[model samples]
Target: MATEAPQRSQLSLRPLERDGFTARVLRSLTAFIQTADLKPGDRLPTERTLAAQLGVSRSTIREALQTWQAMGVVQIRKGSGTYLARDVRATSLHVPVTINLERQAVLDSLELRRAIETDAARLAARRGRSEDVERMRVALEEMEAAYAEHGFAIRQDRAFHEAMFTASRNPLYLQIFQQVINRISDAFNESRENPFVTEPYADESQPDHRRLYEAVACRDEAGAVAAVTRIIDFVESTLRHDE
Candidate 1:
């Protein structure tokens, strides 16, 4: 037997757009929960219900919730609805924060990303589960689709890295990377200097990502490390050339 969905109150903001608009949406949703006196462990409205209430599409709700889930603020249980995973203000205060990065800071961060990511790739090749391979594949296909539409993929790009971190079977790696992603992506996007986002290299990167996936899929540690190096090398060269 099917149960009926419940009605929800409409949010104040409507019609969210791009350019950090998603961040604003998340903020607004958090505010809604806070003002409503919602507490940790409180169940949230379903996506369809939330979208209707927020005057946005269900996809927007899903995206915001995904980010919130990643941030440890919310949890989605299969057939059990969503719940506030932690107290919002606590997570806000405890997570390591990233401020606006300078050019040198960006480079340093990339170097750190390169270091952590290469090792993570090697570990993924040795330790990856079947689910990990599938996730990388889905993220790759999403990247292709996003490229077909918008010339480059931003969220999919991040998703791929997140998949790799998960595939590595290393929780700390994913935790650390997620903590820095907002600042790192901001620096890369604002500069427009990423090899993966520009032409020639951008086109070349599709196969590179494929190769990285294959290396991990086959449990080829050396191959995975090499593939990661090749990808990061392009970024290092591009950034250096620009300098």
Candidate 2:
């Protein structure tokens, strides 16, 4: 006698509360995919269906789907529907840690950066090659040029620091920098919008980047550490004053 196939489980999503709704939605969707035994190329439910199931607005569902799409977890086809871009059975939905523009959180993030980056600066000075130094120079020059034209050099600034991390020649340092700094960078950007500030913080911080690059180029480990320390201290002082 032929046996019947096992029944597939239903997609059951709990109503998400207000706090961390996006995160909850991601978790719920992950659970639904697992329970439903979804595979790559499988189409997800309609926004309306997912919204109703999760007790959220269709916009919220769309936003979650868009985020997943960006992460390569899902693929959204215009006029068709969202489909799984990859098999999520062995994958966990990762929610990036968001740092609020709150005072303590900003300070804590800066402190953590200072601790890691000071050591990274020293390591870069010691281990960095000529090419690594050139990368820092290019990023710094681009940052200065962008700041001169736009009064903000967010991308170039990040690239400069990323170059520094790369120059450190430590994969772990680069990894940690990406994970921690990238997550909290939005908060730092938002903090610059404070109406009370006399000058653009980026302007004040520009020289520090150049100094850091110079130190690393010359292989002055102590100077590199000092430059990194000064940069963090200045940022901390500015934020503290704002508070």
Candidate 3:
């Protein structure tokens, strides 16, 4: 009897629910963009088809597309349906190779080159056509001429690698490899102690270059891998010694 009965309060806890419709629709559209490798001017599926695929209403899909269009991520065509915007960004190209000069970065990049390019060169040798072989030969010739005349053969070097990648017959690989090499070449040139204007690469580099070219010309896969690896290793060693 000392205290009045305590008042009892009832509390109800409800589990949190996430919005499903918009998020799912957006994710579905994003995945389609990536999987199709859709470039600018590529048309997306009709609203009906997209809605069916996403298991949502057409309104929801339309809403998502509208949001993307507002963000300049996609474009809507009059009576022509929706198309990807002109500014779709490819991640690899835009990514910056910073100047942290991390030891791991160099090692990793080299490792990637060795893993992919060794096989690329091997393929170039085994399957390359006469035109490809001739192209490589021309590149080497130009490189030699540059050596003798100017000591630097920037264009020639790029041409040789481009020919090798073309020989691989894999377009995706060729595109990415070319980009990587281009960046590396820029860095390598910048890091050189003596420009082509001053000191040319040692004569030994010519023979190694010739060896690689011949391997592709002759369709000698193993020889091509060996030649490429040897040439790259030599360059790396020389650079390290200079450093």
lDDT of 2 by residue, 1-243 (tens): 996533443546788886776677888888888778788999998999899889999988897787677567899999999999987743543443445546688678777778889999999999999999999999999988988887777778779998999999886666556646655564555664542233377778888889999999999999999999988888788878777
Badly placed stretches (over 4 Å) of model 1 are 1-70, 74-84, 87-94, 97-100, 188-196
53-152, model 1: which lDDT tens digit per residue?
5667787778677767877878988999889987765235323334446767767767777888999999999999999999998998898788777777
Choose 1 or 3, whichever is better by lDDT. Answer: 1
> Whole-model lDDT for model 2 versus the true structure?
0.79
Ranking by TM-score: 2, 1, 3
TM-score of each: 0.61, 0.63, 0.57
> What C-alpha lDDT values do all the predictions have?
0.75, 0.79, 0.67
Top candidate on TM-score is: 2
- 2 versus 3: better TM-score goes to: 2
Q: Of the candidates shown, which would achieve the greatest lDDT relative to the real structure?
A: 2
Kindly report which residue stretches of model 3 are placed more than 4 angstroms away from their true locations once superposed.
Answer: 1-104, 188-202
RMSD of each: 9.9, 5.2, 16.0
Report the alpha-carbon TM-score of model 1 versus the true structure: 0.61
State each candidate's clash count: 0, 0, 0
The alpha-carbon deviation from the true structure for residue 2 of candidate 2, after best TM-score superposition, in angstroms, is 17
Cα lDDT tens digits, model 3, 208-243, are 789999899888898999998987786566555555
